[model samples]
Target: MPAPQRSNPAYRAIARLVRPVMMLVTRRDWHGAEHLPRDGGFIAVANHMTNVDPLTFAHFLYDNGVAPKVLAKSSLFAVPVLGRLLRASGQIPVFRNSARAGESLVAAEAALADGECVAVFPEGTFTGDPDLWPMLAKTGVARLALTTRAPVVPIAQWGPQDLLGRYGKVPRLVPPKRITVVAGPPVDLTDLYGRPLDAVTLRTATDRIMGAVTRQLAAIRGEEPPATPWDPRRAGRA
Candidate 1:
């Protein structure tokens, strides 16, 4: 099911503000857009490879008729004009490692309750996987999925790294890159929907969602995932 072109005035405003800039930066190929539910709130989960993936991904969702409300770092909301834009766009903030950390989920639930589309980066950060495949993810996705019992939609994207790979501090800015966004069928979590949100249940659901995202990514790359994903902690990235 595809969503309307714009769910609200805010989204329309954001689109007008961003579309032109992004159009000049890259080309896009979005597939499986029909998988998005036309109505009702649902969760969209995906791998995070670069800072700009959200911008590219948002274009895919918005064009597909789903207005996406993504959970972003709280600090972004503290910026001057950027903050106002985010709020106007109806974006949610995630306060990591602080007393307010849990607030993001609460806010997300409210968005879902309102029948809006919510997007999540279950891995919590860009892939630490050396090869850029998704790494072991946090269980927040499972908790949210079980809490709202909303559709868990997964998207796989590639090529953003070509423009802005992992904290390079600048986009390539020369050759325009083509970013690919592919939507996978919503993950099946019905078995765990009515169950307890226990640690085990959350972890299981997280894995299932990550698995679906990884598979879609693999399809886009035309390659298989490594048997063992890279771990920044184990690799001493810290």
Candidate 2:
């Protein structure tokens, strides 16, 4: 077997602290780890289910030998100790709806070039679908993948919602939840490569990426996803 990916001292330190807590809170059913690149940078894209899914997602990747540098909200970087750890661990802060928003992509591109796994929750927030299915996502992930030509690995996870609901502030820890996370092969964007990054092109690529994620989730859930993904704007929830 190939050696595991090495994390920086800071990331390793943080992982030591987080891993045990993750173990206490959840049981893991991870699959398709072979799909992860044994080396080099790649984008790990997953569906957004709840607030705590990020922890579970990171747990999967970290245990599989890759240290994930997530693109997180800017406000998270302002929180006390968390902010310092985020910076030290090299997590990218996304400045949303501002001139600096693009900065996150630039940083992510650089990280990929440096051979770091960059994890992205393409849904951008909790699934707006009442069924907890992945909703239509923004095209930023597609844009990043196309621009960088980095491999995009589609992952699906379930069960984090049991720990923390969509809007619940309290976590239920009595029964440790089973967090099932599965990764599929890198999305096939080769055909779309070199295409103009126009609206049509971007949306096409975005749908394919999101479709891959949704399909993985469907396999895990043993159910079919909606023919059309939920759109908050169309549902009057945006």
Candidate 3:
């Protein structure tokens, strides 16, 4: 299958213009971006702290010359203008609630099999973690990586919570605040694919991947490790 391609001169131009604004406001820093493959199908697994998470991921990838096919929630495409903009930018819509969730899987599989990069938030939704730490993730990512032999790139982000505090989950027309983004080494799940998709195996693999993401988050924040399986309400304490 040929890699999916989306062309939107208008959206690309807008994204290019917005990159500077994002950089100026967030004063962001990126590390280990070289870990991202220049050409191949890989899964970009990231923590979901705020609505801007996707934008941060997209900006970094685009800046690095990789146009990722983002798996976004279908609801985000409801608005007329915003929806159009997202579609123009090559984002794939996944209907999480409907029976159509398989639709996204099909699309993602095809994209990866075609040697394209696809980004997924394993949490499926915001963790609502008071400190913006990652929560237990879903198994789709594991399934995808295992089945397709695609590399899983775990990205840890901090400081978006500050942006959340400034904007309170609402977009601010004003300038941006400080945000930090970090990319970790890609995870290889080649050994896990051949096994049966049993519950125990799936959870074990997901926990392993989440653990890596947690470590990256700790590195970025310079904080002690939050309790395993990161609980936001109790400060990730057991």
- CA lDDT, every model vs. true structure: 0.86, 0.91, 0.76
Q: Pick the candidate with the highest lDDT.
A: 2
lDDT of 2 by residue, 54-132 (tens): 8989999988988899999999999999999999989999999999999999999999999999999988888899999
Q: State every prediction's TM-score relative to the real structure.
A: 0.94, 0.96, 0.87
What is the TM-score ranking, best to worst? 2, 1, 3
Off by over 4 Å in 1: 1-6, 236-238
lDDT of 2 at 38: 76
Per-residue CA lDDT of model 3 for 1-238, tens digit only, reads 1112442575476576777677776766877789888677788888887777787877777767667889999988898887887787767898987889888888899988888789888888777465667777788887777778788888887766666552365655356665677888887566677898888778777877877888998888888765756554454543
Which portions of model 3 miss their true places by more than 4 Å? 1-11, 171-176, 230-238
Candidate 2, residue 228: CA error in Å? 0.3
Candidate 3 backbone collisions, by pair? none
Better of 1 and 3 by lDDT: 1
Native-referenced Cα lDDT, model 3: 0.76
**Over 4 Å off in model 2, which ranges?**
1-4, 236-238
